[model samples]
Target chain A: MSKRSIIPGFRLSIGISVFYLSILVLIPLSIIFIKSFELSLAQFWDTIINPRVLASYRISFVTAFCAAIINTVFGLIVAWVLVRYQFPGKKIIDALVDIPFALPTAVAGIALTALYAKNGWIGSLLEPLGIKVAYSPLGIIVALTFIGIPFVVRTVQPVIEDLEKEMEEAAVMLGAYRLRTFLRVVLPTLYPALLTGFTLAFARGIGEYGSVVFISGNMPLVTEISPLLIMTKLEQYDYAGATAIAAVMLIVSFLLLLLINLLQWSMNRRMTANS
Target chain B: MAGVVRYHATTKKQTREKHIDESLVVRWTLISIAVLFITIMIILPLTVVMTEALKKGASVYFAAIAHEDAMSALRLTLITAFIAVPLNTVFGVLVAWAISKFKFRRKQLLLTLIDLPFAVSPVIAGLVFVLMFGAQSYLGPWLSEHDIKIIFAVPGIIIATLFITVPFVAREIIPLMQQQGITEEEAAVSLGAKGFQVFWRVTLPNIKWGLLYGIILCNARAMGEFGAVSVVSGHIRGRTNTLPLHVEILYNEYQFSAAFAIASLLMVLAIITLIVKAIVEWREEVQNIHL
Candidate 1:
């Protein structure tokens, strides 16, 4: 008798998947590069390097970096607390960490605008200190940080939970103080996860548009982000300009995410080896 | 008796001196900081959505969502999600099966390509469609000649949504199925089960929860998608305006109450998505324990 294959329909399934992915993802993404190439080198350089575009790129990168840093610090704290402590409404707090993931970005934008507008709730409090959040670069950072929080918290939480408390106990038993034990024993273990979270947050922040637009005020050469600038170019029917900016974003973000994944893979290997 | 009393005293002293956990002050401080951050960043925004929606009273809020354009926007959002979610769901299952069950060359590259959409900016996702089908492209003239409009129309909205959410279901299911392995299916096949029968009887039961979770997330994203859909939607009121676009129009028109009211509806959907997600996670945990 002929031996039958264990998993049937491999050809059919692979065919459909390859065809669908090519049409929906591969082909469309390639069009961006091809369309951008339609411009000569000088045109591409001018489109991407004009003063306004440069300013927007700077603002996008700076704010995203700042937001990612802030998220790393607070996200670690949040993840640490959720994994180690028992508190009232713990489940709800855990659920709330994912609100940004599930919440519509547009809704987040409007709600944040309402809270931080000069006359809004939080805005009223900060205004006394001459701090403006809504319609400024600060507002853009706030929105990015809000959306990026879950990335850090979720990434680090499982690692924290899986950590063996025995190592910490042994350190304490060796006469290490609380702060010393955490710094030496715990921080090294968490460093890779923290870095991964930071990179992911930074990557997402770079491409974020919906939540940042209303809060950013879109002031050219000031608060304009690369994504918003791309939108403006599209609205004006500047397809080449739009695709050029988008291609730059795509390359930078793709490289950053690839680096992060590599870091994570290596970290996983080290962790399993140590255990 | 004297030795026993001395041992008790030493044990009490050790208990007092050997406390290794964080100080009460430090613990409370960290907890408070976490709570404060969450409140300011997450909780505040959620409450603000509801408060602002009702700031002008319930009647006005109700009227805002009941407006003709609002209803049409709601319908369009539902229609687009209904089409996009199922299409992606089927595609997700097929892709997950291929990658998890079969060996292939360039497997890692295929996986990364699948995730390309997530890394790409949503604006870019929308732009690619326009570049391919807008009035300026090669297909544009041909499609227009046939009276088929893909850009600035319902078809454009659906395509953009599809692109943005294409990876959600597959990403969720691939790892799950990989962990499950194929031994059960292999055994069932060797026992005389047909392809469809084996999948339905053996694989489907194991993956149904994960599939549902993925579908919920994909549907939420499809319904809430703004950036990509906004780029191609043309913002035609009562025509191509999805719910998010409608919120944008109302906000831009200086109708704050109406905008927040419409936003609150989406917020409710977000809440429901989170609840379902939590339940699915809990169910998965229970199943893992059983295993």
Candidate 2:
């Protein structure tokens, strides 16, 4: 048998996959756009640009952005410490990093709310300091940060491990100090991975509903997120409004994902060229 | 040459000592921050789930979990996973086989299309279904005349879960099958093995671990899916409610102990998922080292 034709069922396999995805993913997703088209151009414009809708878009984007930034900094630190340092319970900490990914977001939501509520453990501590966490924009960020914790760590970890130690040694031999070596050599190489992680986390955070809903207090124009707004509209039977807002969020998320894929492709190319 | 070598070694030793002294401080500081951050962010929530669940004592915790609605929610969650995971797995395997074994055009686009669910918001995922099949959609009236309901029903929940889990198994298997190549299958075919026989004997064994890894991940998300399931569930107690939704209802009703109790079950599931994941990765690594 020719190697190319050795495995049969190519036609059957591809046909089934495309048909399955079309039914489950593509066709349903297309409904968002089609349904939203029920609104006139001006009506669609008014629905999306409503102040409450605008506020939600702002809140969701801003909080997700802040959370991604937080994860990028702290996630990089966690990834670095896990890679470079040998601490007691290192394995345990490493395992725990994936908790956010594994845990149901609703569980995380209520658990985090319990921990950060006014009478809750950490919230009680922060209450005396006048720093409210739960039921505020800050709480939204916390939920998002928790949701996104693994993205940066998992994305940057293998890259950090695969990093050439010899490069750092060479820099040291050239009279660069420890700080300089990392800042000049290590940080530059990590930028693409960090950015990719940041984008993923940000994308996830923007659409996050389960975790953020509990902590965000659901206050309209203040704590209301875009996803929650969609939920609210659906609950009110405002299907047109719901699909309109959903369409906008969908477009932004798709753009962000496309960017990440492009970034990953380039990163892979760079690695191959270097090796 | 000997004198120069000696001088170089002395300078290197001196610089190393100084560097260690300074780097030690930086290292410990970073480690402390990382440890403290994780403890607060990850561990504290985990601890709270258990503590709050048991706050009213073990009896209350057990009572909460054994409640009629809670049990039904669990049943519903299992059913959703039971249906969704297998369908996705079959589709995943077929997609992986087609993409990996053949040199095809627009392969990248195919992969991207497969990953489309990962990018989509769960709320949007549910909304898409509602838009497509809900009572207000184009198909809704005709479906109602036929007495068939999709949205706000079990089918909707399953569809949303399937949408969210579409990429898992295929993603896991694709690269693995590609790396393993078609050599073994070709060898089996040359020896007069038939198509299904080649796949069953040669291809399945080589990619089993990755396939399992994918299934585990798909099942985890399938069981834990909240937002997508939530939208279509309609929150009808004991009927459409899944486990996560049950937690939300109990929590919202100020049944704190009950909510956490239900949540604790999911917490355990998540932890078990992590342990299994770690084991799989370790086995893969060990296999690689042996090879």
TM-score of chain B of 1: 0.92
Compose the digit string of candidate 2's lDDT tens values, residues A6-92.
578789999999999889888999888888787899989999989999999999999999999999999999999987767899999
Question: Relative to the true structure, how large is the alpha-carbon lDDT of every model?
Answer: 0.90, 0.91
Candidate 1 pairs with clashing backbones: none
Per-residue C-alpha lDDT of model 1 across residues B14-118, encoded as one tens digit per residue: 432353667878888999999999999999999999999999999999999999999999999999999999999999998898888777778777788788888
Share of reference contacts kept by candidate 1: 0.75
> What is the Å distance of residue B192 in model 1 from its true position?
1.8
Off by over 4 Å in 2: A1-5, B1-22
* Chain B, per-candidate TM-score: 0.92, 0.91
Clash count (model 1, backbone only):
0
lDDT of 2 by residue, B1-291 (tens): 443444344345344543423377788999999999999999999999999999999999999999999999999999999999999999999999999888778888888899899888899899888888889888999999999888888888998999999998998899899988887887898899987787789999878878888998888899899999888889999999999999999999999999999999999988888888888778776666555
Model 1 lDDT per residue over A46-143, tens place: 99899999998999999999999999999999999988766788788899998888888999999999999998899999999999999999999999
Ten contiguous residues minimizing lDDT sum, candidate 2 chain A: A1-10
- Model 1 alpha-carbon miss at residue B264, Å: 0.5
Q: List the candidate 1 regions with Cα displacement exceeding 4 Å.
A: A1-5, B1-20
